[model samples]
Target: MTEETAPQDGPDGPDGPDGPDGRAARPDREGGAQAARPAGPAGDPGDAGARRGGRWRRPGPQQVPQPHPAAKGMWRGDAGGPFAQMTVMPGRMSVRLRLTLLYGLLFFMAGALLLFVMSVLMANILGNVKVIGFGISDAEAAELQRQFVEQTMRQLVGRSLLALGGVGVITLVLGWFVADRALSPLQRVTTTARRLSESTLHERIALEGPDDEIKELADTFDAMLERLGQAFDTQRRFVANASHELRTPLAINRTLLEVALGDPEASDDLRAVGRTLLATNARHERLIEGLLLLARSERELTARTPVDLAEVAATVLEHSARREHDNDVAVHPELTPGTALGDPVLLEHLVSNLVENAIKHNAEDGGELWIRTGMLEGYATVQVENTGPVVPAYEVERLFEPFRRLNADRVESAKGAGLGLSIVRSVVLAHRGAVYAVPRPGGGLIVTVRLPPGQPAA
Candidate 1:
């Protein structure tokens, strides 16, 4: 073994299981500055102890120093300090900054050019003149002329520079005010955009100014919002009408099937067929109900009440325990107070759908499910994790889309119309919450939803 690879121990040696700062240390692969024993080849037991010593050395290419995150957005022409500042994002430059710099530079250049021209004219005029005084020798006259020319040139240069400095300062100050005024409409546009949402789609920029580029932009933005509002209204109306029309027929069909199955004169085979029809009809009803709920949940909620997410999860678990038990899926819940402001019924539906999907698509035997609710990062959080077949990372996002399943085979066996996650996403969005799912390393998925906390009751 090389001397560098050989492990040594002494007072000056790498700290054993602790760092120089007296904290437990672990060897980092990047070889950061910590008192660690150098790491060696795999299956080497000494390397493990070296790692805990915080003195491990990595072999191979050195790691590059990462730039500070605050410095990442800086650009080539960005100003050095607070007085003159601009941010440069990729493919774009700050318009306000560009205008200010160009204004100041152009003014200074013009002033400098004017001074040069005036200086050249003055020099020419001085060069041709002589100091002609009575009883003066040619030498004396030449000396006096030289003095006049030197003094004139010096004064001209000094005064021109002072004037240029004053004018340049004025140009920069004016440029800032002018740029801000010219971009006032843009600020208004941004403010409106920040405040806009499904409920605030009716608000318009309505900029009152000259019919210039900024005004035109504001008008165009307003037109786009108008079109979007109309489209949303049309879609919402169609969904409402379709849901009512679809549900009536499904109800009638279910009633007819139940009546047929109840008939005493019905033959055994006929009764079996009637029972099958009833089951299929019930599935159709559920599919329709899911679609309707999904549509409603996509819209902004007009009314919100304080709700305990933990209680919602508890209620769902209670109702779903028997079903999970029948399917041999174990249910484990850690419910804590996670309160938020939302429609309680919709919150209940979100929890129920998550639990049902976890149980339904879980392992056929010895399945494990975890449901938890608590406060996380100042938000009410609900999380559900389950063990099932290996779910690919790429397919996790597709599960949230309507009528989408991991596999076509699962559509039949799981009896999932594939709208459970879709509804969950819609509800979460309607409540202004965030939902995420990640596949476990071994198998299954971990789903988490975070909603804003509710205000304390008066």
Candidate 2:
């Protein structure tokens, strides 16, 4: 380091760490000035101990000269040389910015065009005034008329040019505003999308107002994110459920086979083990099939015709009434007339899965189930609530995912594959609907489904 003058003020400020003035800027070790210097390849000098409060006193009239590292990069210098010995950072001109320059150029052109037009108009007026003011004899009358005709033509041309210039300016202004308005929604969607992660999938980009292009764009964007969130949720649940379900059966079969080969067992014991394995295998198959169906529903993009959601709910009740051998739930319906436009197959699946889920999770000792359907806004909604054990609030969202089951208490048999809720969610999505499973107030679980209604096409 080059030798330089140390501050004449002893470097340490008047205030100390515990002083009334507050902590000083001087290094604790040096008891003098605290200066940070750029390090060299050789090594940096020993740094003084940190000041208690990291305050640096403002240097007085005297200035301290410090060395700054010379910038070394492709853009370090311009044709004129380095700017005050500081490197010029390279910057890029984006397409939008470059296009903006054309705007400036057109602005200049419009000015030029107006000036040229005004000049010609003024010249013609001056010429006509001169012709009318100057005296004319019989011999010069024809020449005067010729001059008048030429000036008249020039005046007409100037007027036309003025009109064209005005049109161009109007066009440019309108074009700029329209283009900006068109892309505004896209900008909002982009910003929200960047902030989105697995944790914030619930946030939506719902554009309000009339069904214009920007509104439509926002709607489409929200739908895509919605689907993605669902897919991720389903995948997570499927993996967990499949692992749990498969492990149970494998463990049982291994134990039974080991017992039969290693030790003598009664005929009844062996048969019972075989039956358990068979039942587990059946559940495994159902889980796999459910997973496949959910995957297919998520992948579909085409919209389906609108049907009556209330009717679909009623059909599902029929299947639920006889699904389980011993599901003794008392089902009641509060049906209302409504229409819904969506995939019929998916709609049916949504209703069936929800009601079946409601009944299955309830106790067989006469659990109560309430199925209600009615017009909700421009669509139809069905809610199936049943009496059962209380479900925790935090786990409500996860239960809709494939292979997700809440078994923290471990009270019920954990052997069944956890794909029912996942399927319900997937089918609901295919119908462009929403599904939520909540702990029913006063009793059981509530599965709510909402679908858009279809109106007659114009």
Candidate 3:
């Protein structure tokens, strides 16, 4: 490195010239390590070798995460579909509104493109015009060049718009045909899906072509329908079992009552018989009521209204206060104000059942209680909690069934038909609401009911 030839340092670079990046311009310790710099305006290539790290800039919504090694052979275009995912919106834009919007956009674009093409053609053909008339001389043409261009442009725009009107008519008809043809499959899917039910779940859409998304959708729906059919069958069996159990006691009591009243020797035993018969009748009535509650749960229709949940809770607590078992139980109502969309009568019945059940199972001597009712965002919920032994984990779910109670002995004596929770569930279901029972965190059980608010089913 003689002084004359050794690379000189400049204000912008280092001695041996490490240009702005601070990399060596000359060979490093390794013979292969020297990076050359770009020669100014001359095409000699140099150390502008790579953009060091963080060089290339992206414009929008970064998607730089490297693909997984396991995803070999998958195309890069799997990020999103051409259209948004198919959504089952209860409502959509009206057809007239959509058509008008599309046509308006197309009409504007067609007129603009035609006008641009016509103007370019006219400018090439006619040299210029003077004061609106076509000119021959170069001197006059030079003076009126801008004026002629402006006038010609106006004429071209007008002519192109006329032509565009014709194209617009054709485009509208073609667009309508294409849209209808494309949506025909969707229409078929809609028809097929509409026919689906517990019994008709076997109905399926035929895959007429390739195994596309729509085909996949039809397959998925068929599977869902099959599952529903199985569920309905199971429900039917349960109802049948419950019905048989309910009818037996009624039949026995009816036969016994008739036999006793028929005997002549029974006259002295009439008071005793009457008392026993009354007790039997009460038990029979309760059993029938429980069965009816279970049957009602499977119904799809309900009367709905704007119901005050707090008021219902208050009413239930009052009614439950009169229960023979509730004499010792103190009804503690949180009395939170709430509104729910449901049948007021049914909602009241639901609340009464929950409160009554809590009362029925309470420990002797004025048991503690917690009752709450309140509205949330467009929904309402009611919760009833009581101080009692935490229910067994396994038996909790069964308690909602007709004639199911933790203390089956207490319930079987006809004090309760074990149908209180069942009736609550039926009424809640009829309102398109949900009812569930859970053991409280600390101790005891809490029953909750949630219902939609405002728009109720008629």
TM-scores for candidates 1 onward, in order: 0.73, 0.45, 0.45
lDDT scores of the candidates, listed in order: 0.67, 0.54, 0.55
Q: Which model is ahead, 1 or 3, in terms of lDDT?
A: 1
Compare candidates 2 and 3 on lDDT and give the better one: 3
Model 3 stretches astray by more than 4 angstroms: 1-273, 407-411, 441-443, 455-458
* lDDT of candidate 3 over 1-458, digit per residue (tens): 10112132244332112211111111111111121221111221111211211011111112111111111111111113211123233368745446655865777686787678777888876654344346457767566776667787787777777777777778777767666665567677776764444446566766476688767776777687778777877777877776777777777777777777777677767957766785778777766766665565544332446777867887777766666766787766555445666567667778877887787676555577767565422235566777676676466677777677885734566347888887876665555454545554334566656554543224
lDDT of 1 by residue, 1-458 (tens): 11233222223212222111110011221111222233333533334334333222221233211211211212111123111222223467678878888889999999999999999999999999978899999999999999999999999999989989998999999998898888878989977875576678999999998999989999999999999899889988989898889999989999998888889999999999998888778778888899889988887676777788877988888787666343588777666666767899999999998988888778877998877665543456677878888887567777888888787524443356888888987887666555666664457766766555675455
Q: Is candidate 1 or candidate 2 better by lDDT?
A: 1
**Backbone clashes, candidate 2:** 4
Candidate 1 structure lDDT: 0.67
